[model samples]
Target: MDMATTESTASTMSLASVTLEVADPEATHRFLTAFGVETYVRLRASQAPSTGFRGFTLALTVSRPATVDGFLDAAVNAGATVLKAAAKTLWGYGGVVQAPDGTIWKVATSAKKDTGPATREIDEVVLLLGVEDMKAGKQFYVDRGLPVAKSFGGKYTEFAAGDSSPVKLALYKRRGLAKDVGVPAEGAGSHRIVLGSTAESFTDPDGFAWEASTSSARP
Candidate 1:
């Protein structure tokens, strides 16, 4: 599918996929599957020292066996510790070694035999923001045509423009939020985090960055 144009709004685009860093392949795979992600693409086999797997795909593609070995070697050389060796799954795709960095890369062939129109629901993106002044930031969005839906203490706030699907803009205190989410707090200035939906961002008065969009998945 074509990427969303630059000027499109949140309603015009949807979240396609998210790549996460993980430590274990088997455990991660099992966990995601239990959480309702059954589709997967194995990029390597369980026997190999280094490998990866693709949990979900937006578009189907043919799998190449050579790509698997090359990916493993490249990952090892690049300093990734292998958690699980590459191996083929019973479902028909190859999965490779899991990386210590918590990132799993899978290469696999599409199981669907027929070519047809793509049909799937896209996810909303969520931004975790760190702000210096919560009250002021909340007021800015309220004045700019966004409405607050929820407030947690004086430190966190959620705002949104009306729509059928849930899309929100939020604000939170920097240090406290950082500690809660396990991310280092940004001092100031813009920090860009890209996603599959329309490009958007929020800036606190202190210049801290906040993601703005509905392409994030919460589990």
Candidate 2:
């Protein structure tokens, strides 16, 4: 690694937890619990004005196609709207769902077929943020001491999710991300999401806020 990368790696920040600000914490919490992902996200009551796409998504990566279907089915049964039905694609089988609180979630798996019975074992959880300028966004995180784990030019960037973090971090173009989740690219007002990390509180260029990991909020 070069001087800059070395510096970033040395001070890399770990995303501890993701908190979703919703109008009804009780309802959202219920949905999350029923969906079997209450442990992956925290919830807080907030009436912040927001409309249309939130420019972010929480993704779940499992081990098999059956696991993907299991999550999708549970999410839908718990009041999540299906944005995309689970189906096999070039890369894998996946689907998208919108929670009642307006959070988009994508469940996927690399395995094309099921090897055994369906399981709720989640391999990874990733937080994908959509930004207006990919280069600027990537630099913003890097400047904040987030080392890049993977980068596909300006198309996508994944940050190293330290073992301590609850979820991985990544960046994508605003429109592209919105389209991938089957939502309009346009949105306004608060992002309705908060990132908990060891870093000081600050807002990113895309308006995603990060708070010092002092709050009682835990998955």
Cα RMSDs, all models: 15.8, 3.2
lDDT of 2: 0.88
Question: All candidates' TM-scores?
Answer: 0.35, 0.94
* Tens digits of lDDT, candidate 2, 194-217: 999887888999889999888876
Model 1 CA RMSD to the hidden true structure, in angstroms: 15.8
Candidate 1, 45-113: lDDT as tens digits:
122222222211111123343344344555555544444344444443333332343333333332323
Q: Please report the candidate that would top TM-score against the real structure.
A: 2
Model 2, residue 74: displacement in angstroms?
Answer: 0.6
- Model 1, residue 11: what's the lDDT? 39
C-alpha lDDT of candidate 1 relative to the true structure? 0.40
Off by over 4 Å in 1: 1-125, 164-167, 186-189, 194-204, 208-219
